[model samples]
Target: MAGLRARLKKTIVLVGMMGAGKTAVGKALAARLAVPFLDSDREIVKAASATIAEIFVRDGEAFFRDRETEVITRLLNAQASVLSTGGGAFLAAHNRQVISDAGVAVWLQADLDLLWSRVRHKNTRPLLRTANPRETLAELYKTRDPLYALADLRVSCGADYSIDDMATAVLEVLKSRPDVLEISRDG
Candidate 1:
């Protein structure tokens, strides 16, 4: 019973850049797996009673990142659930460690052009407050790409991919690695 419970506590954390559909895919994956979905960004917003944009505008990027790290820490220690993190969440060493120690981490990879197209008009993204949104995204990708690559699995999520398709792909990945996940494909 202890072994069964331990296996059941394993979580799947989605790590990727902004506009990579982490939240969308996380929700679908959670539903497919019959687990709850928790977005760290959403959790932070709720905890602070403020939007992410407000946190960034008033507290600055570093401050917002600190809040994100705190939120991720709490969620990582929680029981079975799908966690969707912010774009820069994995960039922090401690944040990456928490994900690594907790459960399987999946990186949803998207190209810079696709990311810019998706986030260009979004005023809520503090990172995109730049003279050239494309350049800012490119720079962010360049720096964070390697960090995201540290995930246990990397899924190619193109610009127009559906949430269902992404969830299916993640399920397939888990199915292929049943030994690590302790989830039988038949189950």
Candidate 2:
């Protein structure tokens, strides 16, 4: 793991649906690799002095997305770390390109049922504030899965996996991508 940490060559960006454990797994991954953990949503909220739900309500999604891109670009340029992005961030072509250029995007793929189980009670999700949130999430899952498939790598997420387990899974995937994460023999 220390060899993996010392040899990391690019940022590992986590992309997937809302309940895919990006934030949780990202934190663990960063810790295990001795790198920083950055959440684009948290960066946006910090910069705007508001929550994501408030940003969506006030500035609208387009505005927030623009800011998201800016933050992503800024963070990716700073250092190689684990970045957990908003569910919609990877859907943008420009964002995808930038991420591909600067880091490796890893989709934390989760099934609809598991996603729903994890996110159904989370009122913080702006997009799920509709009258029929389950239907909304289902529609989103259907629409976004194809785009999320464009990631550089993917790790299937299951209900049985803990945060550490998911992080370890992502780390294993990263190890397979020598261009993104290098494992030194000496460590």
Which candidate should be chosen as best, given TM-score against the real structure? 2
**lDDT tens readout by residue for model 2, 28-138:** 999887899999999999999999999999999999999999999999998899999999999999999999999999999999999999999889999999999999999
RMSD of each: 4.1, 1.4
Model 2 error, position 2 (Å): 8.1
In TM-score terms, candidate 2 sits at: 0.96
- List residue ranges in candidate 2 displaced over 4 A: 1-6
Give candidate 1 misplaced runs (Cα > 4 Å). Answer: 1-8, 185-187
Model 2 score (lDDT) = 0.94
Per-candidate TM equals 0.89, 0.96
The positional error of residue 61 in candidate 2, measured at the CA in angstroms, is: 0.7
Instruction: Supply candidate 1's per-residue lDDT for 53.
Output: 84
